[model samples]
Target: MNVRHLIPTAAVAGAVVLGLTALSACSTSDAADRRPGDKLNVVASFYPMQFLAEEIGGTHVSVSTLTKPGVEPHDLELSPRQIGGLGDADYILYLKGIQPAVDDAIKLSESTHSVDAAKLTTLEDHGTETGGDEHGHEHEGEGAGADPHIWLDPVKYAEVAKGVGASLEKTDPGHAADYRKNTDALVKKLDTLNTAYKTGLRNTATKTFITTHSAFGYLAERYGLVQEGIAGIDPEAEPSPARIQEIHTIAEKSKATTVFFETLASDKTAKTVATDTGLRTDVLDPLEGITDKSKGDNYFEVMQSNLAALQKALGAK
Candidate 1:
């Protein structure tokens, strides 16, 4: 599933330009301790990341999300207030390439010395494939690289959670021990969730599913399931008629019982495909937003809900 050709050159260019400007305006300072009446101000790209930060940081940190709830992350553009919030925060957490707008805000925050440029543990641009059923699509450029939905997979997310805990400890050494404790608890929860997914998805009757976009690569690979997406890496991509037809054929052949759509993105394509095939369409959230139907206002709950969805969709009794 190489998707390099699908990486929008214009988006990358815009991100680069914004990053440079933001970085240039930022000022760096020696990391300092939290003063009396100070709380660690943290900013995240979207709901999932923010939820993680809030869960781990607890009473010590105040976390905010740059992208509003229910908005497609790829289409997000920071408002003046959001940009200002980034500069005022003590730390900003985001997955690169997943949200270019947040990346730009991080760069800008660097210049203003409002927030420390946190070290990112996950290298997003790697070309490693989270192997499942390859859909034989030739992506030309960086889009063909690895999928950025690492948080959807519990194993990868545990690693990310650990990294975040480490970063939080570094930012506020006074709370290092507490951060480690929180990390351990969060990791345990994630481990339980991982076991649930493996137990639920293994031996399911249907191993292949259809999605509105290529956001479930990590989940599908982790659970030995395959995904056929109508769109590419960019959620906004409009599938060609032929591509849509091809997905229909693949879904029919794979015995796909459900067509999954994301809350933050359009469901028109998924609905059309489901209608044509007479299969049900359901929401398989990417954890990009906090929707009313989401299990709760957090990542772990959302992942749990997704596993339940998979179980029902695959007919895993």
Candidate 2:
């Protein structure tokens, strides 16, 4: 189940900035214990990163997550113990900017073997209706933030898998072959998922789908669809009355039949918008965290559920 227990405490700043790096007090090349399959201690910032670590690292790593199941990741605050444990990890995986506290702590980490998955792929602004640049622009410069939810897009997530595999190989040369093989396998699965999305959404009645947050920008861009978010990239941001009215018009004009809310986030906004727009509400998990309430157990299963929901909402042909 890979469930993490919540910790309550203040963060002790300074840990982790991933540059395709390795970790641990032991050296992989010379350690006899590591040669005998001593698992690397890995810390993942959240579910998406945790999934990558578990699937790609396979039997070579012991993984733990900072974000507990069913918890809203953006609201996650790290306890000092959790932050302190980062220094002991052989590898740390996290998507920068998704969890602000973790991002702040990772920026301070001295480890060179850590990986920021966001750096492995391209990120674009999806422009939430609440407030953001609607035009797809590069969020490269300082003060211009890019969305960090790239895992939702299979194509982009595969790019990250390649980077992580290469990095893991360098860190653990003894198991380099295993890491490479696992990475290829994971990427192949992602490729298959991408093909399915392309075929399923190709003949949809409408390209626009309304969502509570703008987490699916990369997914929408990859699939040639439009995502109209009620709030900005920040999931908790309240939509103004004007923005609500704007969505009503958008739903009517675009023929959007559903309002999608995430499992972790509150469905209040989605229901309100759906009620006002004469649209039905459904689940469109962002894959942030999986729980019993999620449509399916793992990343692939939940993503498939999302596909079915989108298919129905978009009236896929």
lDDT of 2 by residue, 169-196 (tens): 8777788899999999999999999999
Superposed on all Cα atoms, the candidates' RMSDs to the truth, in angstroms, are 4.7, 5.8
Q: Report the Cα lDDT for residue 97, model 1.
A: 57
For model 2 the local lDDT of residue 216 reads: 80
lDDT of 1 at 76: 71
C-alpha TM-score for every candidate? 0.82, 0.86
Candidate 1 residue spans exceeding 4 A from truth: 1-33, 111-132, 139-142, 234-238
lDDT score at residue 292, model 1, on the 0-100 scale: 81
The lDDT per prediction is 0.69, 0.76
Specify the poorest-scoring 10-residue window by lDDT in model 2.
1-10
Best by lDDT: 2
